[model samples]
Target: MTADIAADILVIGAGIAGASLAAELAPHARVVLIEAEDMPGYHSTGRSAAFWHETLGGPLVQPLTRASYPVLEAGGFLKPRASLEVAEINGLPLLDKLASEFAGTGVGLARLDHDGIRQWVPRARPILVGGMLESTGADIDVAGLHGSVLAAFRRAGGMLETGRRIDRVERIDGVWHVQAGDWHTSAPIIVNAAGAWADGLAAMAGAKPLGIQPMRRTIAQVRVTTDDVPDHLPLVIDIAGSYYFRPEGPNRLWLCPHDETPVEAGDAAPEEIDVAIAIDRFETVTDWKVAAVERKWAGLRSFAPDRLPVYGFDPVVDGFFWFAGQGGIGIQTAPAAAMLGAALLLGQPMPDAVAAIDPAPYAPDRFVALAQR
Candidate 1:
């Protein structure tokens, strides 16, 4: 199985991040995308309950999400879908605080009273008194977007090698020698976009590990007794972050308990306890009796200490790039993030799509100062 391969840039992890970055850089450079799994997006990217919410990743990530909207919309990967954040009467103050946080961010939030809450979600309990609607929220076609990016990269002459579990990396002279099983490759630059396993990849490349921690989140599809479930129902969430649900079909709904449990990087599976907790929380939110659980799964969301994405070259490791720690914002921010990463990798000006935002906050050098201190 010994073979030799070479590329101008070698990217590890063929998830949304690697695929999108390859597509962005292919026209200008020879890129090779490597994935451990037989298929791309076998983990986080495939399991995402793909939705583009303006406020999902908080203030720090809003810019990248907003910057990516134009590309996502133009690709026909986004479908109109609003989001509703609900709170109990006593929780109105918290809802108000949330609304004020996004005031001038261009993420429009309209406050809703009791009647308004009922109008948005007929199944909402009477005790729910306050809500906020993010009209710009939309459903993302995750598979479509990932496939399209990979397709474009291939069409542009970017090479892809799946089932290549990279085990060793070494910098010899000015080039990188990467080995996965019996195969070998050499490139001038190595991009770590390994999702939950990003830290391990960095360590393999003799780069500083950014302390990326993968947290498990559970989602389930269940049949509810409520007959009013509509296909157009906005994504309903609790401002308290306890639970969220939206109609999936005639009588089925996609629900989650909003759980984030710290776990090791691996193939994640759903815990029955988490699924039961989700069902219990959903029952308390409304009168919808969960008739049965049809499906359940779990995925990991990796984060840096600051909860922001890491996207720059390692200050100490020459030719090594950091494109990890995106967390749940990875999917929504892929397009813009790739463009930004590509721009930085090539030492070119920031693309117009993300020119307003400074890249310093996400640079690997930020961690250098912190590590020194």
Candidate 2:
């Protein structure tokens, strides 16, 4: 049997974006959040590496990351795990460029000599010793952050429904009538936060399409004895990002090739070839051996053509909003992104920085611009 519900704000996906926005909007409006899976965050959100990094991307995304850092720090969502980048001797040039580009963003990394590197990770291979950059990076508590948002939404009288796959959508009398299987729902504003399925969800709502694609990123776990490894060592990434390894538990390390393979929506599995490539890359840069394997998994990182997040209303659709295509930075940038989303939904003025950086660049309208010309 299908149920019917009405709300002032209807959020289609319950990942970081939808959940956070629901929490933010619930205070001022009746909010409803629905997740297709039996639970929220069952896809990309569940598979995140959970790190607070500000200087990892281009200049455009830096402010959002910086703006988000304060909240994460204040709310106790971050742990000072620190971060480092090491490469073979030939990789020094790229490492230097990275440091120069991101110097002012508070990462404050410096080149480490061979002796300095030894002080951090003694097991690092000497022959591959190009140099390293050590910075005060934070380890994020993803579950705690997401849960906090959920709790906030619930306390504000927000409603959430799970396992409701939206099958159809229609606008009637200037309101959205949505059907998820037999259940019918209505809302004055419908937010499309469907992650990898954002574009498809927009189409279902009769809104202008945004070209969003889902890219798969695979990660693996390798077992090692902790006797020789320093407990305080930061996460070590390759200069080229060919692969990276960070201490996980007392006796294991988490590794990834940082691959980006395009895929369809759903739970993603690690490719054997990707694992093999990661193993080769990890072994090449570090002294660690891949003798024992603890486990492995993969998740999809959705992206727009421009690789920036798409937020704001569909220029062609009255109340349909776009809030997907976060790539892999959803967890880190959710605070600011969700604020911008709620602002757009409520027809309120955006923050000065958000206004300065025109949301049109990342809007669903860009797809129409491409076709218009």
Supply the TM-score for candidate 2: 0.91
Clashes of each: 0, 0
lDDT of 1 at 180: 87
Q: How close is candidate 1 to the true structure, as a TM-score?
A: 0.97
Cα lDDT tens digits, model 2, 1-373, are 1228888989999988899989989998998998999989988888888777766655667677767777788889998876777777788897788777877766667788667777777777675565555565788899889999999999999999999998888888878988877888898799999999998988888875667899889888887644455677788777776777788776677889989898888789999899889888877666767767778899889998888888888888888988999998889888877777787788788865455545565667777777799
Clashes of 2: 0
> What C-alpha lDDT values do all the predictions have?
0.91, 0.81
**TM-scores of all candidate predictions against the true structure:** 0.97, 0.91
lDDT score for residue 370 of model 2:
77
